[model samples]
Target: MNLSKYLLIGLGVLSLHSCDDFLGNKPKGYTIPEKFEDYSKLLNSSYLMSSSNTVLAYLTDDLYRTSRGEIMNENAEGKLIEYTEFNFSGCDDHERNLYTFKHGQVLTAGNSDPLWNNAYENIYVYNAVANNILNVPDATKEQREAKYAEALVGRAFEYLNLVNIFGNHYDPKTAGTDYGVPILLSEVVGDGASYVRNTVAEVYDQIISDLKTATPLLPEVATNVYHPSQTIGYAFQARMFLYMGDYENALKNANEALKLNDELLDMKPYTTTYSTFGRIVLESNPDETFPEDVDNVENIFMRNLNGAGSGFYTAVVASEDLLETFKRHLAPDGVDMRLRLFFATDEANFTMNPSATPEKFKGYSTYAPYITQNAGFTTPEIYLIAAECEARIGSVSRALQLLDQLRDARIKNNVHYVEETDAPNRTEALRLVIDERRREFAMQGAPRLIDLKRLNREDWFRKDIVHSADGETWTLPANDLRYIMPIPQTVLDFNPDMPQYDR
Candidate 1:
């Protein structure tokens, strides 16, 4: 494999650089961190952006191009093609880059953009901690074990997301041959070390192995949501199992997570106002003086989105399909309270600078899934997982009971079971639970897109789904390789030994 410029920049684990220097500037008199405290600090740095990434949101059905016409917020920096992802009737050659292994602007090799960079970079950090922290002479065994467990859990989480984001969904039959991302558990030691990609199954095994081994070593709950805790570990395991289509294990781990933290944010209190625009206007100066109580409850292990370019996912208009879906769940008084709680509407008093054309921005709203999608597991997500698993295991009644627990909080006047056509049989119950998941986790961008990929393996949607916008449409067939992003050509070029998926 040819050496990559990105590798020289991002993969230098042995000779470290300061936070400000990406060009390998060795700060004056710097030394490798040898204290347990130093490695603990390293663990903290990786969790900074573990909470939410909006770039992944573009791949889901919850996003749509406006019907009036496609229009870029004059000042939007990420480019209009970034938003045209899900609904791209008029996407031209330039805008079609997202359909390949490389999701963002192909840089001059060393400066690959954020979406794929964030996860892998954190893995490197965790690997550094896990590989060297054990040698800290000043650390006690308990302290060493605890920090080791955290690094293991963190590495597992990063690898899990990396494989799903860069590799194909796990197909048991083909996983042995399917390409997952590189399994870089240890720090780089040799010169010109060409990294080889592991199979999807190998990657999943490592993730599960790390999580299970770390569970007993981790604290029952972290002092705060910013770091790993037993609950977060269990929650992540539940997520992994669900994605792997292991419903029994998914339900078991979700139940374990619930035991640790089962609180859900009630959408009722926050329903007093409705806006499609969200709390802040797009392209406006960000509102930073914000922090609320709701962020603590179900978000079991809170984290932040560390990537600099991680913003714009919430700046666009809500999909018309999403808007209409919310309308169908209206209460007896004809209101779906979630609409007000989850969206910042154009009808709201929020201001849009330079103002968008009315036809282009009418009914515009931004997605507000939680107080914000900062990071961590939510109580509601676990319940939905349990409910879906229940239906998958042929317990429709139990599933509806669990589904009601969520709907009662989101819909006013006790609008029960998501909608009137809720699920009658186990198949429909599972479908309803999945439907509710799309509604519940929209703008979240993680579970929804992952759900689409994993479910397609079972041929969940019999027919292809069409995404229509601005008088043009694109069809996405079930289990298509497009569902899984290709390993970036830059990555492939860097490591010729790495395997490529079908795409």
Candidate 2:
């Protein structure tokens, strides 16, 4: 009963369909195996499919916060950029940064950039493995079905992230009219490389259809944290429905994901010294080391981007804006120490990177290459998503329950609970929930954008956001085209048949 033997047989089964003749030449000093040798490489690629290294993962944060402003610096020179034209609001206060882009001043394309290219590249590899599994020879019926389900679920998750950033939200009545990304189901090369965009509806339809078909086929869990199973599928389904405004389904799936997995890590177990972000980092809880514990009361699916060298972990400080907001909202008696624990305060004699001149804060370009603590989505986020869906469905109590589920874990000593009186009524409660989400998820980045979009507050989002430093205000205005970034121009150039995104 050696499982190794069975694993090898399984790998053998996986290889027959994955070997691509197109990879004819091995790298220098590398020998081309006669038969497909590393089936696990395909599995590994899916893990890397959406890491911090990929443009798809990191750029989402950059576009949303666009400004380089530090809310903590009262005398910080050069406020974050604000485009004069609402569509270009994030370009810069001067408007000089506007013209270089293709549409809405969003970055168009660059010969040297690989962010967009990497996303597409990931999609291709996933699709290849999926297709190979589907057509694999001599594979067991159950094994093949499981592999197919994994591939479909994995690919669908990739596309879900893709559409959120690259295409407009699905407008049920007009998705067909909106532009989405090109649907590259199979691998292509040479003259056939170019592809046209798929209609937004078509792109989502494919994702929904694929998930629908693959959901039941997936397992309850997988040995590798990277692979998809029933929980990931449900999580994605919940996320998709939330994006679609299908509140009922969103609520259902969100709860479903919670049921399949509900293990929240309680930070209260730690002493006050290690309670803040700074303390937590320097003196981390043993629990923090194994972040992917599915039973981890806070995370659903986390991309493994751990270290300085590839295949390692890198610690990141909370962004300054987020840091200030946390400090501003600091409970008078001080309850939430996560801010202090999560952010680095070695700025005593700190000088901004010379390149970040005028911006005040160092942009990613000038900052050292390390993973931000806020980079990947985490488990507490699921509770937030569940809370949002509950609020949207007018279930204030349900939403409050979810919030409590999250807050009870973080409300510092003696104050085992902080009764949220702010949630006096349903509407106020909903808004409070959104506000709490902003604070809880703070620098993490997903909930804020989703909250703004869900509430249709894109216009007043920034202006309404309080700045602790100066009462300086900023606004993103409603229906501002900038809210939806232009689909990468390279996408348009490659797929001329696809219609351009409406400005």
Candidate 3:
């Protein structure tokens, strides 16, 4: 039941596979999980896999500069550097050294940064669990199958993220030609072998295949939000389908997830409080620390970041544009519950050592476990996707209804539902939906960037996205190759044939 027990057992399982943790330590002998329950515990351990995606926010448009009195500390500056130029596609063309990195070179910790390394490591761990759990001697057939299903779901989610981040955006025309990430299905046992990149289509097929296989095996409910359930699997499918531009399947999966659990957190209660961030963790009580209190009706599956210290949650100060946009749409009063509750009035203030009273509007960081920040895949996301789907199929009224459902919950006093009249036609309705989507998922980071990548392919959603800080501006045009990150140089060095995405 304890995490420590699972940690040792997890490490023991990992040792058997000759896997390396983030800490570069010599391999040691340990026992494999003989019981299915032990493998279940291993799955629960944060150390066993990558907990949350902290780095995706950096690649997003949600971040902006905050002018402050004190000089930024080294850590803050480092983050700013990486935030500006880590995309690797346009760094060479950019002004001002384009952040601390050279063009075409990715930020690295051993091989790549934590996001890349942790993700692959997570894949390795999931592979270990899936390949071994059902064979455990102490479990019944049904229980073993259920645990095995969990592994597949876990593996599927990571691969879904991996392919999207490293591979080019899903294009029927080019996915076959586009390079995807290195697919690591099982633990690497031999002296390290070279890996050629999989095509984007192949990787997508694998992700879909895993999700399809795993969904049927999952229970209706999970032990916790961290664990995947049938509903979570459906949610994952909805997201994948949405990404693939398959509006019909996206709608189907989203509705299925809603049938399982549909709840929306009222934003009214949080009007005067902060949401979550981890920049300054100085607090008298552990409970009062980062991630104040964000458990709400909307969250479908809530796995967050598992790293420490001013983690990805605190990376970006909320941009003024997002705040202004929220104010403009939420009400004429220009004071939304989202703005009041989550963002600080003096957001631009940057102190070297922030005060202990951090509950004060800590920007868009959700009040999550200080150890982790929730990368949301909440029910509202489904609502948004459904709205988008409806808008796509010429259901303007239906799309607005969906937006109102979410808007009514977020806007204070329940008066500000987005109306169909605001966008009378399907094209206009889709535009409204796109705007709402950006506002809804502003601080979360992944969706806006993802939306940009996919939506930009169309002439309608094609607007230049500008990311700026300290007088430097990086303007991304529609469907830029920079959207697709370069595969690591180490990956290229190992397999020379594994072509990098366009620089």
Q: Give the candidate number with the greatest lDDT.
A: 1
lDDT of 2 at 41: 50
Distance from true location, Cα of 327 in model 1, Å: 3.2
Off by over 4 Å in 2: 1-39, 46-105, 112-115, 190-193, 269-297, 304-331, 345-378, 413-420, 445-447, 457-475
Least well predicted 10-residue stretch by lDDT in candidate 3: 1-10
TM-scores, all models, native as reference? 0.80, 0.69, 0.79
State each model's CA lDDT, in order. 0.63, 0.50, 0.61
Whole-model lDDT, candidate 1? 0.63
Report how far off residue 328 is in candidate 1 (Å).
Answer: 3.8
Candidate 2 per-residue lDDT over residues 342-399, each given as its tens digit: 3324322112232332322332211122223422345566677788777666577778
Candidate 3 lDDT tens digits, 374-490: 563788889888888988874778888888878777776545434545776777888777777877666554567678788888987687656664445667667766666666554
Summed backbone clashes in each candidate are 16, 20, 8
Q: Rank the candidates by TM-score, best first.
A: 1, 3, 2
RMSD value for candidate 1: 6.5
